[model samples]
Target: TKIKNEFPVFKNKVDGKKLIYFDNACTVLKPKSVIEAMNNYYQNLGVCSGDRSSHLLSWRVQELVEQAREKVREFINASSTKEIIWTKNTTEGINLIASSFPFKKPRDEVVLTLLEHHSNLLPFYEQGKRRGFKIRIIVPNKDGSLDLNLFKKIITDKTALVAVTHLSNVTGLIYPIKKIISLAHQKGAKVLVDDAQYIATHREDVQKNQMDFMVFSGHKIGGPTGIGVLYGRESLLNNLFSYNVGGGTVQSVKIHGNNIKVQYLPPPAGFEAGIQDYAGIIGLKAAVNFLEKQNQEEIADYIEKLSHYAFEQLKKIPEIKFLADYQNQIPATLISFYFSDKKVSLYDFNLFLNHELKDYFVAVRCGHHCAQPLHQFFNTSISMRASFFIYNSTKEIDILIQALKDFFNRKK
Candidate 1:
């Protein structure tokens, strides 16, 4: 309850009841500090930030931007700020890497898993089509868990990269990324982890994991949308071909008698080609600072407990068939489940939770949750997801259970 008050969104009533935000996987509610930080940027310094300007506002903006970069670096325990590239979202970062990565065509291969989101899969799939690189897929086990032996068999010296999700959005299963990174390294393949879901409830140490590339969205955390991060090793980032080119990318461009010469800036600036989202960056910094102050370890433990509680509670409902691994510890903060009753559709259940359920709105995600392949693995078309965060509580879970019981009773 104390932590819940930090988010101003809870103050507002939805359909005559308090809002129960269970869609943390899609996007978490922003805290007051993050919102204030963003508003501060617009209100105080609404100017462009780059080398071209020397004015006071521009200098302040530049300082904030760099400070935010440093905060992110510290948050992830990155080696330096040069390794961080600001992007619009995780999708953009994946696309950037897919386009810019040095793929050696027919001989080279990229290893991916069935658990990847469309953002992680499509970029590499499309790139393979253009680059003629072989794409290998690792299928998960029957219960939505990965098999390391299969992964070992799939990854070989020909594999240039192993792109996989740190956590499954559909099943809410946290993959062992550190081990995955080790395996990829053994096979002389770089690893790119889609940390969109994992980073929300866990502390990410890119250095410890030795991750070559990592991508996530600010909105998945407590920051604003339209701002994300792509963390890559400095050397690898410098080697990558530029994804976007525009106003801020190049240091200089000279055109003399139709002979043009251009010198592009280094990694971060080169990758971030356009005028950046200053407010979003500032807001992300504030979000990181907020999380840091709260202590990520404690938050993680709390969320884990809440996840277990939710799992146990949801398991009581016989109709609920969970996609997650319920036999062991539930590492993920979310749970995805489906109904066996053909009469109860995913859409109607989500609708009841969001609007028609006893006047309160229990916000959840419906549909494939962007992991259609995983759904195919489970042999289902769609399911509903209820993801939790720091602000979520056991009381909310009880309410959700009661709501579910009410929903089922009404359906019957």
Candidate 2:
């Protein structure tokens, strides 16, 4: 309850009713501290950083940006700050890797899973198309759990990289990333984890996990948008080609009569091409600070409990069929379900709850959730998801349950 007060969005109401924000998987509500941090940057130190200017504001901005990078490195237990590369979001980070990674045609291969969000899947897919590297998609078990045996069989010496989501955005199931990393390592393959969902509630140690690379969005963890972190092994980052290179990426340029040669900076500087999102970086640092203050283990436990409660409550409704078995030991941060009646439109139901419902405004996501392959695997066109976070409670789940019951009963 006290934590809910920290989020300013809780103060607002929709149609004279309290907002039940169950779309946390899309983005979490920002706290006052994070907002203030961004404002402080704009109000005081709004200047170009990183060799652009030699003024007080620029110096301050540079200092704070590095501070944020260091904080992210520490947050993810990365080996060094050099491993952290700033991007617009997780998609850009993945795209950078896809573009820069050295994939040898006819010999190199990329492996991905069905649990991936579109961000993790598309870049590699497009890259594969261009590079002619073999691309393999690993299918998950019925419960959205990774079939490790399948992975072992699929990943061979030819596999260059194994990219997977640490947590499924649609299913909210946390995958066994460490095991996956170990398996991929055994096959001489590098592993990349999309930690966009996991980073918010779980503790991720890139060093401990031995993952080659990891990416997550700032806004998913109560930070500002347009800022994300891509963590890589320092050695690997230095070796890869910089995808988006410009002013900030290069250290020096030499001009031959007709050809120009450029010397690029190492790791982070080279990877971050343009002027960085100084305010977003500052807000992200504040968010990391906020997360540091909170008991993450407790928050995770709370979210799991709330998810289980929501699952049990939703299961009572005869019209609903859950995408994954929630009763399992695997903890969930969200629950997705489709109506038993195939004729009923998922979008209409979502619209009913989001707009037409008078008792409460429930913000649930309805669609493929950017995981079309996962939906195809499940043989469903679309499903409704109610995701939760630290600010959510059993009371909110109760409201959601009642709203769903009212919607279905009225339809009957």
Candidate 3:
């Protein structure tokens, strides 16, 4: 496919074999367009922007940064560019909300799920401790699907914020975000969605979802690392305190007696402190443009088919057991499973697979996948994961199955 060729990483070799990367959940390979865009920015008009200077180069840089913000605002269907805050990644975006969102009472609550990545979990946990707020965690069903009934019972009037992942990175299970958002709103609670995994392949309409806030990493969507987006309701953002205070975030400063007065800029600028990642931001805009050309729904459907084929092939092996049932959960972009025999550790099996499939360049992820709570719920420490993306093919799944079969046969 032409899309596959767009990524120059495919041309590279690993250990004398073509590179086959299946770790889309962690990060995606950058397309040439994204790389060129970043390189072009660095090569030309690379200068500090925003209030720092009035030079022609500085103005060009400022224009590029603002243009990137508009692209991200349109990408997620946010109301205005003012609501778009530049963050280092999904983790920092969530941290910004956790630290800055107004929690009035001591008993105010923050709700989350067991399926969250550490990035989504840690910030809330740390902030809740300091702010004297209670955190309620909802456990998913045995099938790894969220229980809406339980979720409804947990979010009460006292719940100030509901932080949830739009999709489970480990299980590839999509959450009912629109319903969750509606329920949270009914209880007067704001919703913050961690869309790190979902935004890469799915079209997230923040206005349609009625989301108060959303976060996603650029690296996961064919963009450069060190660039991410945070979408917040403009009203909510304006009321909240800035997470970081420094240079460009402030409009003016005054000194009188022992106290100093500072005037801060509105929303986006207020939250983004110091010099931003100009090149990475530009590359993210390029990535968004590249992805918009391809229909997100079509890409999702294609990945789901690949997941279904992989699941069926893996199910043929009696020793294999899935973390969740894939039949009921259609359109999964990934699958997590482990050998039931328990003779081989997940790490050992991953090493074996990597060695055996070096020629075919089959690569997969094997670990707790940064969701320890979810693994604990299943009573499993770790498992193997094969994630599918737009560039992946059914032929790759076939090769993976054959490799697994060969490994099992050799073990016997």
Q: What are the TM-scores, per candidate, against the unseen true structure?
A: 0.97, 0.97, 0.97
List all candidate RMSDs to the true structure: 1.4, 1.3, 1.3
Question: CA lDDT, every prediction?
Answer: 0.88, 0.88, 0.88
lDDT of 1 at 257: 100
lDDT of 3 by residue, 1-412 (tens): 6878999988887777776778888898899999999999989878888558998889898899999999999999998999999999999999999999999874399999998999999999999899888899998877778889987899998999999999899888899999999999888999999999999888999999999999999999999999999999999999897788898889999999999999999988899899899999999999999888878889788888888898888889887888865545753788889989887666776776667665756678988999988888887888888888889988888877887887888778
**Candidate whose lDDT is highest:** 1
Model 3 ranges off by over 4 Å: none
Model 2 reaches what TM-score against the true structure? 0.97
Clashes of each: 0, 0, 0
